[model samples]
Target: MTRSAAIVLLLLSGCTLQRPVPSEPDATPMRIVSMNPCVDTILMEIADSKQIAAISHYSQDPRASSVPLKWAMQYPVVSGAAEDVIAASPDLVIAGPHVSIQTIAALKRLGIPLMQVSVPETVDESKKQISDIAARIGHRQTGANLNAKIDTAIAAAQSGAPPVSALIWQGSGLVPGKGTLADELMTRTGFRNLSSMLGLKKWDILPIEGLLSQPPAVLLAGQANMGAGNADSNRMLSHPVLRNIGARIKIAHYPSSLLHCGGPIIIKSVARLAEIRRLMEAKP
Candidate 1:
């Protein structure tokens, strides 16, 4: 039997001891496949358990997943290949913005429908995306419930504390600037992004030299606890100049996981930001 046929046979046979979600079905279920990690998160929130045929393989990796790996592992995974998608037998496939032209054409040729979602730069955009994706999945009320959760998070994260100047430092000298989701999160958590003073754009590099001069009251390092193997990033973090600023800047962990993608994740991201902001407030 061919590889695809063999896999189909495996599904057809009674060997489902290892796979979490089996691939056999009659023709009545709504099997939705998510090819993006962020999309995987949103789908988990709005779609019924039986509606999810497969999720992105990325969600299976704790290092890259936006959702909890323990939760995501309960579903099947596909690595964004047309063949893999076909094996899942999806009625609709939702993908991230970076889908290749070839993959799109292949899906089209195979008669599988595709929906692509882009990264939202702000919280409002993220809310709209959640509702829209939920609507498309035929669970409009569930989508509204998710959006209500975001609204609650936003309200709870509202801070009366003064806007302390801060910079969200990610690995390799990259920083989030105005109009990005990180920036909005910081704003809501009582942080005023210092990247604006350095004339940075939406997403730009803020070198160590710039850090020495334009220090903020708080430095939220995205890779502070991780990415130790990145030699160049390590050198930047361990720079002699950065060592001397402890008395002036409050360096704290702002995990790289929160840097990209927003869905149900916005709640956690905003909460962390507020926690750090409150820490800063408690100090002189």
Candidate 2:
């Protein structure tokens, strides 16, 4: 072959051998399954609807789910069953640190990629969790924006009003004490956690006599209404004595979902507490 002809032929062959440009990088998870409700909520916020294979069954329950039930119902749910997860054929399976060991072992045995996210105990930890998950799913910018919103809400809540004495009272007089997310949130939102004032530690139940002796400025009920027509369950919160005492104190409702998990709900919870603070300050 002539030199020029040979050169041209070689160039053509090189072109033929060149690989076509790949389509956009698969940033989204092809098939995602979440075994934890908290992970399900995070995935819903960051992942595309089509990318989700299945979500935790707890997300389908209105009382326990952080995400809206209507939105959760749009996706299929799994009960953390290894067979169900394997059958879903998910490329990435997200779970909490506390998921069943058998399920984790089964997924590992099958060589499925499993990501375990732990429950964040503070606002900073919660933000880190969001960033970590978002990066894992190739949504770093989304995670940054979410963290920004959380920070703004926190600042607004802290600056809303002066601190008031507040007790996070739940069913059976249970109180979240120092070192808990609720305690930190309450302090940040301009409230002195009565749990600490009353010498209650983490996860302690307050005695009725002790609480009556030292009343708080605000009684933040974990449930909006604990009146389920059950006398035993309602005795502490609904008793006429407690109701009479509540008349002199600020009573507010704090949802159970906001307190259980840390994520986008922190924004709403902080904002709500700020509003309550403003209202309390406005009161004569």
Candidate 3:
């Protein structure tokens, strides 16, 4: 064969010799499983529904869910059980700070891609968690958008008024002191956290007597109506004394739902807080 004939033969048979066009990358969605309720709320905000195989069953529970129950019920739920996760056959599993060690070990043993997140104690930390989770699922821009919403809300709620002494009285007089997202949020909304002022730690129980001894200017009552029929849950919040001493304090209902997670909920939480603060200012 002549050189021209050989060249044509090679062109026809040796396609690999031509600068191979890089094939388009696989477009398969990353099948993600979330074993934590907090992360579930974040995923619901940043990831596509098709990407999520299952979210933590806790997100389905109204008492524990950070997101609205109606919205959360639309997704499948897993119990954070190894068997449940394996059955989902997730391409990646995201666990929260409280995920069990055994489950982590099992996932590692099975050679599954896994990522874990911690409870964000500050606003910056919460945003970072959102960014990391979105990046893992290839939704970085969505995460950034959500973060921007948080910043806008924060700016809008940024209070220039003087800080009024306030206490976040959750069910059974449970209080979140300094070093918590709640504490930081209170400051952001222009309220002095009375829990920290009383020398409380990160989380502590504030007795009724303690509250009465040095009542704050505002009371941000949380979870007051969670278990309506349960006396145990209603005891402190429903006490007659609180009603009688009402005029001395600015009482507002800050629900337990808003206290749980920080992602999208922070926007609502901050707005509510600012509204409450404005109410206090409107009053004497």
Candidate 4:
């Protein structure tokens, strides 16, 4: 029999001796397939390497993944398809809030266990997510340890001098405003979020004309580098008018991989912010 067929047979036979039963206290998933990039990082960090059957295809892309490419490449990539999950025969499938309803429904129909992680808006929410996922995957201790590291990094990043005004300008002009993890990170890292400074609410677009009229001292542009190629074509970010405005601003490049997700990425973002703040201080 093929490997997938054997796995399906094992599942059908109710092989309690090999896999952890749902009611077990150590109900760890013997095989895990992550459908979300954020979940991919969490699983990679808290679960044993052998337990991971596959991670999101985005995890293998450096531009979108929080995990190192070398490490992420060690696992197979899933495209959020139910068939892929079935072929992998993972004991647990983890997805993000944005996953399609069709995918979720398909998984449920196949009697697969699913963990949907909500988008965290605050630091406390992020911590809770880490703890929740860890416990679900039977890695409570690992989760606690990772939280300690994030807390320490946040403390260190919080230290230093007064905050500076900065704008986190993602591609096409979308900006994370108040009540978002990005907003919280900015406050912790000694940089005031210009979106909040301008009284912009959550999910508000940062107007290019407004930005050019009253430029921030620092611009945290994600995915705006020249190598981004035609990806920035016709986008206000790469428009010639903004170039003049960008020249007067200290534009610091923040990785998009570190922007959206909550996991070990938080610690990395905090550290990167510290370096950026230091550079701004050193300027004439």
Q: Pick the candidate with the highest lDDT.
A: 3
Which lDDT tens digits does candidate 3 get at residues 1-284? 95435434544464333222221233333678889888888888899888888889988876577877887888778885666776676778889878777667766755677788888999999999999888778888999999999999999998898998999887777899999998899999999998866878899989898999899998887635555543224357677898899889767878877776888889988999999989888985
Clashes of 2: 0
Top-down lDDT ranking: 3, 1, 4, 2
Look at candidate 4 and give me any clashing residue pairs. Answer: none
Model 4, 1-105: lDDT tens digits are 854454455556755323332323346887888988888777777888888888999888765667888999899888865557667777788888777676677
Off by over 4 Å in 4: 1-26, 197-199, 226-238, 245-247
In the order shown, what is each candidate's alpha-carbon RMSD?
6.0, 13.7, 13.6, 5.5
Task: List candidate 1 stretches off by more than 4 Å.
Answer: 1-29, 223-235
lDDT of 1 by residue, 162-204 (tens): 7999998877788899989989988888999999998988999
Clashes of 4: 0
- Against the true structure, candidate 2 has what lDDT? 0.76
Q: What is the C-alpha lDDT of each candidate?
A: 0.78, 0.76, 0.80, 0.78
Q: Give model 3's clash tally.
A: 0
Residue-level lDDT of model 2, residues 1-284, one tens digit each, is 85435434544454432322222234456778888888877777777788898999988986568899999998888886665776677778888987777678766755677778887879999999999888877789988988998999998888545689988777678788888888888889888898877888888988678788789888877543565632123246656777777677777876667676777878988987888788788888
* Model 4 vs. true fold: TM: 0.84
TM-score of each: 0.84, 0.83, 0.86, 0.84
Candidate order (TM-score): 3, 4, 1, 2
